[model samples]
Target: MRTIHTTSEEETCEAGKIIAAELRVGDVVLIDGPLGAGKTAFVRGLAEGLGADPRNVSSPTFTILQQYRGSMPLYHADLYRLAPAEVADLGLEETGLDGILAVEWPDRWTARPTVAYLVVIDDQGGDDRRIRIRR
Candidate 1:
């Protein structure tokens, strides 16, 4: 595991970009963070790094999941509102074959991807955040 500190939203996004560069198709990124913890900000940078518009990236908390085309596809999923049993109906496995999956609140899911990158964001109070990454 590794840790990074970000004092601003841009820095958080920049950290996401760094992480994104290391991603490949079939990669799964598991993110555990509280609301306002900059999870979406990280995804925006990830989308940007993959050649997609960062502005187009948003939390899929309401819609469940979203796909963005880039150098490769980005499958962003949010399981905040889902129950464990309902997670399977989303057909998340199919997304893994064709794009990178970045899942928020992955702890809610009973099954996880075979190979996943674990990222935990800890709010350091104010605007600072500590992002911990592991694979």
Candidate 2:
């Protein structure tokens, strides 16, 4: 487990890029944070680090899932607007089989991968944030 602190969105993104270096295909990352905790910003960094266009990354809250082709692939999911029971229909684990999976609002996912990295972000007011990564 590791903890990182950031005072701006850019720093938060950098933290995500740092974590991306340690990821591999078939890996799941569960991200838990408040609505404005910079979860999407962190994912943008992930996309950039993985050779994808960061500008193409966006919150998938309405779309449910978005796939990006990077050095490998990135399957990003947001369950913010979905009911917990609806999560299974997406088959997230299989969707991310060929790449890394990053899920926001993962607590709504009852069948989330047991072996996965957990990222918790706490908003410390203004642009500051405290991010904790656990395996």
Candidate 3:
């Protein structure tokens, strides 16, 4: 486990980029944070690192999942609006068969992730986030 203090959103995104550089296909990144904690910003950095179109990545709160093709496929899932059981119904583990999965609000899902890069976002100060990355 590693804890990092990010003084700004750019630092938060840079942290995500570092993680993204280490990521390979079929990786599952679990992100937990409160509203406006830079979860989506982190995803944007992940998308950029994966060689995906960062501008295209957005909060998939309504859609549940969004797929992007890059060096490796990236499947972004948002469980914010779904219950645990409902999230299970989406078959995340199965979808993870092929591409790398970046999940926000992963606590809404009941199943244990086999290999998870857990990222916890903490509000340190105004526009600052303290992100802890645990393997």
Candidate 4:
């Protein structure tokens, strides 16, 4: 387990970049946070770190899953709206193969991935966040 503190969004995203640099294919990153807690911002840095176009990374609130190509392909999943069974229907196992997966709102699912990095965002005072990472 590891932890990081950030006073602003940029710092949070930068931290994500650092973490992203350590990622490999088949890596699963599960992000847990309340609304506006910088989950998406972290992923933006992750995309940038992976040599992907950061502009192409966006919240997949509607589509549920998005794919991006860079040094390695990235599979971004948002499970905020789906039920556990529905999430299973998407076949996470398949999507995670040959790519890196960054998932938001993974609470609905009961099963865990083979290797997953957990990011918990704790909101402190204004613009302050405590980001904890565990694998």
TM-score of each: 0.95, 0.97, 0.93, 0.94
Candidate 3 on 48-107: residue-level lDDT in tens?
A: 888899888888746999988888888889898899989988999888567689999998
**Could you give candidate 4's per-residue lDDT for residues 30-55 as a string of tens digits?**
99999889898888878888989988
Write the residue-wise lDDT of candidate 1 on 85-124 in tens digits. Answer: 8998888877757879999889877778757998899999
Best by TM-score: 2
RMSD of 1: 1.1
Report the CA-based lDDT of candidate 1 relative to the real structure.
0.89
**Models sorted by lDDT, best on top:** 2, 1, 4, 3
Task: Note the residue pairs that clash in candidate 1.
Answer: none
Decoy 2 TM-score against native: 0.97
For candidate 4, the lDDT comes to 0.86
**Model 2: residues >4 Å from true position, as ranges?**
none
Off by over 4 Å in 3: none
Instruction: Write down the worst ten-residue block by lDDT for model 1.
Output: 107-116
Decreasing TM-score order of the candidates? 2, 1, 4, 3
Q: Per-residue error at 19 for model 4, in Å?
A: 0.6
Q: Where does the lowest 10-residue lDDT sum fall in candidate 2?
A: 54-63
* Candidate 4: worst-modelled 10 consecutive residues by lDDT: 106-115
> CA lDDT of 34 in candidate 3?
95
Clashes of each: 0, 0, 0, 0
